[model samples]
Target: MNLSDLRQDDLGLGIGLRTVHFGHILENWPDIDWFEILSENFMHTGGRPMYILDQVAERYPIVMHGVSMNIGSKDPLDLEYMQELKVLRNRCKARFVSDHICWTGVDGTNLHDLLPIPYTEEALKVMAEKVKQVQDILEAPLTLENPSTYLEFAHSEMSEPEFLRQLANETGCGFLMDVNNVFVCASNHGFDAKEYLRQVPWDQVLQFHLAGHSTFETHKLDTHDGPVCDEVWELYRLAHELSGGRSTLMEWDADIPDFDAVHGEALKAREYRQSMSSTSSSLEND
Candidate 1:
């Protein structure tokens, strides 16, 4: 399948649609570009959550980011969940659907965590078939995000970017490149973060995820509980240039803050993009 067949578009700067800002959004109808909603939150709801979602969907562009697709599981694909996801997308008129590249569970038991997978030939083939199956079920390209891993498999064969690039080439799946995850994993695994960005399949990247992480004594964790740090922001600057710009979203899942603060943090992406444009103009004149 061709990259253009994915039908992904640049939606501009966005923020994750969290419950804390629902009332503010409903009342003010802020001038945000779009909102990325957790797909599972609305899939099984018929009460106030669904009502709030209906109102939000009418005003802003929605994209479904899920955590339960289990794309790499050994178990069979969950058809019932896939149907629910499709229905939610149709209801919200979501632009695209996304989930992590790692597996969530196996044997019909959900561990409720984004676990890492081995980057081997066998694993790659399994993921490719699962991605194609999901795309067919949803009738849209499935965008997968790179997870922040705490450990690496000893028997892994390739790097994360190489695996993702090959998967995209084989199955025509899009990617949600998380810049913070790159920085965190690089620190934990001792790889160069810039090199990781250089090897990504930029053509298949439909969006970028920017967030904050916490530093421990020995390693860093993907907390997403604070603002985007300078290091991660720098990586995002390079990613923005590499991808020629894409829809950027700020994720703050814990220690929740006010609506204005979260939205303001997301707006920092515009500053980074503008700086790149300014530098280019200066070089052209000189």
Candidate 2:
């Protein structure tokens, strides 16, 4: 896959459009490149969230990111949910629709968490087919984010990147590269983070997610509640250099501070991109 074949535009740095900052966003109209909406939040709503979204959609390029696609679930695809997602995508004119690579629940139960799937060939075929079905219904590529996993399935046949690479190849889907998750998973699972980044199919990367994670005695949790750590920032720098830059987003879902604070964190990615660009130019000249 050539890098130029990426579907979405390089939309610059943006933040997840949260209700906490709605007033500030509507009033100040801060200098942000785009906004990513949590798709389920607006799917069944006709209230203030939808109202704010309508207003924001008019001003910025919005992308729909969801947590409930459940692409890797054993159960069949959720048709009603897919229809609602289509409506929302059209309503907001979202550049693309995305969700986690893992399943959220099974057996008609909603777990409300991004649960990792085993990387076996059987699971791969199932997920790739489900992704294709989702794309067919939405009439667009379904970009998927890598999940922060706590444990690994011993029965897995392939590595994480290998599974994603083949899935993208089979379904022509896009990827939301979460650098923080990669770092957290690497630290937990004892793999080289840089090698994981190298294995990613960069051409299929549509967006970059940089968020803060909480470290416990055992493992790191993707809490998205604070500033991005320095190691994650370095991983973001590497991702920028690898993918030739993509639309970067900062997520602060929990304990989110004021609007300026979140946007300030998001702006750091812009600085990283600029620095990488300058260094690349200098190297080229040298």
Candidate 3:
């Protein structure tokens, strides 16, 4: 397959590559089309993670998803980290690099959390510039995610989708459109998720994230702890229909189940996508 033609996947489903499923994957090499790996997991000099990464890359296509890009922070770019990532991408033949839009740390301190940024013009500009620097260093555009936020900024200039579009315009980067993040944000901020999805530039979407979330009395949290809810599944179906079925990934990070359970959830997504495609084709035939 011409790699560029692979906007999503033939199977329309992907399992988040975890260590627990590595052996099963290596042994059988299941029918999974692709896998997304945490960029930090394989950043080390040498270890089991790196070895497995090499094996997987050789077997199936892999994309790099990271936590510590820290694109929105005021601090300078992490050149050292980027260099290591570039090497990893080269070694593993990663399809693309992606990270959350929030900042991870400041003042040379790693907070180990994807912290939200204020929705101000200055903040947007800072993030766009950082994305540009990262792309230039890596000699390719990066993918930024719409994070699940708990708070909103008092001095915000634009909506979250507007911020994402502007960031893409400035940096010429693609997007990793996380449907669960938008759902969590909407439940927390009381905005319409469909409007957010409509306003986004769907053509530039490189990946689609589907994961589970938890709801509290005050708001919902994008915790990929369990199966994706019906609401999230509905939104994901809409997104895939809109984006022409981009790369779809099922993320169940915490309380991860055995290999069979994860694979089953992914297969369910593929079924949903196929059902939608059939409906669309029927309409056209009429």
Q: Which stretches of candidate 2 lie over 4 Å from their true place?
A: 1-8, 283-286
lDDT of the structure predicted as candidate 3:
0.84
- Top model number, TM-score: 2
The alpha-carbon deviation from the true structure for residue 237 of candidate 3, after best TM-score superposition, in angstroms, is 1.3
Clashes of each: 0, 0, 0
- Could you give the candidate ranking by lDDT, starting with the highest? 2, 1, 3
Please give, for residues 25-87, the per-residue lDDT of candidate 2 as tens digits.
999999999999999999898999999999999999998999998999998999999999999
RMSD of 2: 1.7
Which parts of model 1 are misplaced by more than 4 Å? 5-8, 278-286
Ranking of all candidate structures by their TM-score, best first: 2, 1, 3
For residues 124-181, write the lDDT of model 3, one tens digit per residue: 8898888878888877778888999999888888888888888877777888899999
Which of candidates 1 and 2 is the stronger one according to TM-score?
2
How far off is residue 174 in model 3, in Å?
0.6
TM-score of each: 0.96, 0.96, 0.94
Q: What range of 10 consecutive residues in model 1 has the weakest lDDT sum?
A: 1-10
lDDT (CA) per prediction:
0.91, 0.92, 0.84
Residue 245 in candidate 3, Cα distance off native in Å: 1.0
> Given candidate 3, what's the lDDT at residue 161?
83
